[model samples]
Target: MTLRIRHLRMRAKTPAGPYGADIRFASGLNVIWADNTKGKSTCMQGMLYALGLERMLSPRREVPLPHAMTSFLKNDDETQLNVLESTVSLEIENGAKQVITVHRSIKNALVDNRLISVDFGPTLTDKTVRTERRNFFVVDGGAAKREDGFHHFLEQFLGWQLPLVRRYEGSDCKLYLETIFPLFWVEHDVPPKFHPAAS
Candidate 1:
């Protein structure tokens, strides 16, 4: 089964003001091109964060990268510190014409009193069909499992299975969609020395 993103919405409450982006994608080969500091990567990261896969973006960093929504929403001015609250919503459609809306937030904390919220539903406007955060995660032996929330749902919804492959010898590590997503969503990071050649 094929999966396609219908729409994406990101919103952040900042000291200066509210900031957000609404984007729509087509079926195939959609490209987001812009000059430096135009929020191209931010948009991509927001979508990933919305799906609870931001951690996979920088797996090897000493300190895991902050949530894309909250981190970038911070006020630049240090004089008056302001806590930024952010949210991301994604709408996806399957080949069977079933549409699902997933909403994740860094501000609202309802499930398990955690700062993160992950919820989804059949349609963007329908609230009665939404799923609770507690139901999103896999619970085994009366404890939350290490499995990802959104990834598990997508796998079952699309009937796709993720393979467990070793990165190297004796490595018991598993592969995730986040690790592989970068291959398709290539972001060019040209160094200062290579700027001329890139241009």
Candidate 2:
């Protein structure tokens, strides 16, 4: 199936008030080139954060770096405290004439309560559509099931079911979509020799 990203929007909260970054994608390969500190990585991280896959980019440490939402909202000095309220909205279209818009938000709260909104329609260009808000937390059989809200919608939209599989031998872990995303979206930090490792 063909999945195309039509647009990406990011809004950041900082001491200087809120700022936004809006991007539009075309049909073929899209290239983003700029000088150093031009927000290229920030923009890519925003898209991943929007898809609820920011954890893949975080380093394995005792205490992870600032949450993906707050990472980009820091001021130039990076000293003062700035509570970031970030939002990522993505418009995607499948080859089956189905288009979906997924919206996710990050807010400063005690419970880290994230919100997700999904919109579905016949095509990406459709103006009139139906939107729904999903609850990531659900209780089933007296057990709490905290599902990844954004990936759940993405699985349906892309018509691909992510099953539980062992990542390595004798490891009872499953491979997530985010775990394999690096194969498709290679970052610049990768060394030339390891470029073939993803394959």
Candidate 3:
């Protein structure tokens, strides 16, 4: 599955930067070009929200960060951000392209932040079927549930018990990914790989 975001607006009542992040994702590749403390996390948070991740690790927040940052650009509407939108486009394997825009609103309190995503419009044949799954299992988010899938990180951090079914098969089990909705996969903060020579 692939996704693209364009012309997204995540405004606030302060002066920062983008209303939202402009990004795109293709065959296991994603990239974002943003400056320092421009609520880059906010736009990423929007994607996390759009992708439907129940738990999110907000970088840091005050004044509904997105809205607060947006307020800087907004002149006409001093008290509120005029528009906050995130647009996404996808190309299915069958060669069908679809676009979905989420018009968001952050007209609320800082302690009680809010993000409202509106399905702007799209060019697709089927409207009923959900093209994308929302259950976002991210690495940096938080804890995980056993039902979501056998999270090895949970096992590492906490502990794991083998199921009776697996035990019966004489399997001393260790599993990695559960739902495949990897939030960590997007992470590229890694040192270079290497192999040791035979001593």
lDDT of 3: 0.37
lDDT of 3 at 148: 36
Residues 2-121, candidate 3, lDDT per residue (tens digit)? 334433433333333234333444444446545555455665655444333323433343322344333334443454444332232222221123454433334434321233232424
The models' CA-based lDDT, in order, is 0.59, 0.60, 0.37
By lDDT rank, best first, the candidates go 2, 1, 3
Could you tally the backbone clashes for each prediction?
A: 0, 0, 10
Q: What are the TM-scores, per candidate, against the unseen true structure?
A: 0.63, 0.67, 0.36
The TM-score, computed over Cα atoms with residue i paired to residue i, of candidate 1 is: 0.63
List model 2 lDDT by residue over 1-199, tens digit each. Answer: 5678788876767676777677888889888766665667777876776666666777432112244356544456765546467666787788776667766665544334345566665223445655554444211111111254455556666777666776556665434566767878766743244455565
Model 1, 3-74: lDDT tens digits are 787788877676777777778887887777767665777777767665656655664422132444545533
Kindly report the root-mean-square deviation of model 1 from the true structure over all alpha carbons: 5.9
* Clash list (residue pairs), candidate 2: none
All models, RMSD in angstroms: 5.9, 7.7, 12.2
